[model samples]
Target: MFNGIVDVCWIPFAGFISFLIILSAINKSVGVRKAYVNILLRIFEYGRASIESASKENTQSVRENVTSDQNASVQPVKDVDANESTNGATLITRDAVLLPQAQESGNDKPQTLKKEEFNFDFENCLDYVKSGVEAIIEDDVTSRFEAEELKSWNMLTRTNRHYEFISWKITLIWMFGFAVRYSILMPLRVLVCFIGVVWLTVCTAAVGNLKDGNKKRAIVNNVLGQCFGVLSSAISAVITYHNEDNRPSSGICVANHTSPIDVLVLMCDTNYSLIGQRHGGFLGVLQRALARASPHIWFERGEAKDRLIVAERLKQHVSDPNNPPILIFPEGTCINNTSVMQFKKGSFEVGGVIYPVAIKYDPRFGDAFWNSSKYSMMQYLYMMMTSWAIVCDVWYLPPMYRQDGESAIDFANRVKGVIAKQGGLVDLVWDGQLKRMKPKKEWKEIQQVEFANRLKSD
Candidate 1:
């Protein structure tokens, strides 16, 4: 009975994988392939837009309510002035200084008015009125704009439901398909990857023993790394170069980080020296091996003193032409490919032209992101192996130079903006360390304060 059930499950799983392979082949041309992918991506885009619209509406509604409440609170003051005028009594200004209006008396001379001063919160009242008017105008404009956008996308929402249902069904089939594929291919893939790593380690160790110069060893290591990348099925890289001449021989290279495979993708293309925090577990072994083969910089991220030392070392490395270009992920941590976080200013402060690289992955076939916090290195590798393929796009943008009076922070932000724009990623103002823990409001405020202080000290 179990064998019969297993056979039944495998039938649809096998069929789905076959279907994907056929689709992939049909869309082989880059232009056709991108258009086809965009068709599938429309559903996700519409869903995201709807969510944003709803959020904006909610915020506007809250502002309107607050404005109304403030107006209600102020209405009584206006009523008091109206009542005084109707009764022909002394008019009291907001400051409580009474101004007596002239009244006809039996005598022609007007009676002297008593100078009674009342202390009303006139400044507070004016402030409330000004804020209420601004809020009302802003809320009305935003609400109208969001409503128009939502109306334009009405047809998309209707059409998206049909495709979304189909996507869900495909997703279910993909889950089963991957499970069966992993069962069959995981062991072999592991063995192949292990052998590849061991081969590189042995070759690197040999070079170190021979006392070859660092530059020579680094070039050889990079060639080997490319071979390993291909063996691991990182088969295709769609690169867009902004300025070919901007590829510097020795300077800092900053890139938006996505996955561990990023190292392989980059090393396959250029002989760049990497700088990162020390890793542990299986990855740590690879890091230690690579360190022997090249003069890469690695430091403990949590240590303030270690960071200062790293800054000095980076400056020294960039000064030497014999050294390869030093690569740094200035975001300090990997983020989901949808967004790029704030860039750390240490690399920007090195005071040289910096090259920015933008990387994006196509999730239509397989997701290339390695969520290291949730999955171990081995698990992530297995996942990658079981997927259909890993496809990526890398853009090497023009080198950016700091302006005459620009601070390092401003320079970093300018570079980050260009990279984010080219990469089709949202630019976020979040600190990468937010990934480690959920921050409370107090924590966020404290972090901002610390960042401000650090800037001042710099």
Candidate 2:
């Protein structure tokens, strides 16, 4: 599996192999291939220099802050100016004495404007060092890449036939590989599931926790779920009806989270209660709006009583024939589509059909960390923008019936194993014994017959 993987992944690796074969055929040395990697090396150098510069700037800022703190009681060293504060100048500390607002009646100290402190003095020093050391050591890489692209595109647009023949062949290599690998081969089937994440976080449809008891946006909610799933997936998502008329009746829906987009994928047009974290500041307002529109909510998993109240409310949604299924994440925690995590036991408690869905991210944002990590949302956004390879896989298992004695934990485990198997996270890919989930019913029924025969003999 890994062998087939390396061959299909990334242009540089594929290009290297092609170059080597041609050289070997003509008995030429492989050293000429080194010229192609200069761009990559230059990029690495630029990234390293940027990081080093940022660290030095931060260290200097911190030292200045600490020094100011030590002399907090001393006389004001410099006149305060608004714009200077943002550029590593002295700042208003919490302990500083504040003058009353100018809006207050009878206050008349006029504001004074100070001469600008030139940024060029500091910037020139950095640039001089960069040009003398960094630039000399490395080509002006960013500009070089831009220039190269311009040259390549300019060459491609030329009408000359000889150049056109070679250009067409070169273009085909990159496009054909990207199309077949990302579209036809692996094709980011799971990336289709990214919409569910967005739904939970950023859809305008949410409106926030419902106050109207029921204002009627069920169909719209469900439609958005399917639409976002389709839009986010790149391949349009189709919502198949579970009941006779291609309409999904009451059931429990479970999914994985990779990004805020998942929310849009899961809740679009569905007349059901969507649940989310209770405490994210503005979420309270949004939840209130959704509450007014429908009965969706803000849930704090840590609060047992609040959750029980929410769970009871969920039962009402499931009981209502007009409302759609309760969509949920069986795994309470988010996970990178790596190894499947243990499923949370919330949905099976709702009873009725348990819709088991296996969510896997695709190439685009598939490696997205779902587990708890210290990374900021801003950082995740930065990576998502530059990398541009996130895909999600959603495999919906047939709705299951919950038996009277069966616990939610058992049902969740069964679903988790099926999802794990279907998503290809475990087994032949990882070279480990796959943890077995519940066996297929057909296999179980056949196995039971043999077990009964053995018991009869005993």
TM-score of each: 0.58, 0.42
- Residues 72-167, model 1: lDDT tens digits: 442211111111211111122232111122222213432333344544444535543554565454432112111111112112222123322333
lDDT of each: 0.59, 0.44
TM-score, candidate 1, is: 0.58
**Listing every candidate in turn, what is its Cα RMSD in Å to the true structure after a full C-alpha superposition?**
18.4, 27.2
Cα deviation of 167, candidate 2, in Å: 21
By summed lDDT, the worst window of 10 consecutive residues in model 2 runs over: 144-153
- How big is the positional error of residue 354 in model 1, measured in Å on the Cα after superposition? 0.6
Top-lDDT structure, candidate number: 1
Deviation (Å) of 90 in candidate 1: 56
C-alpha lDDT (0 to 100) for residue 80 of candidate 2: 28
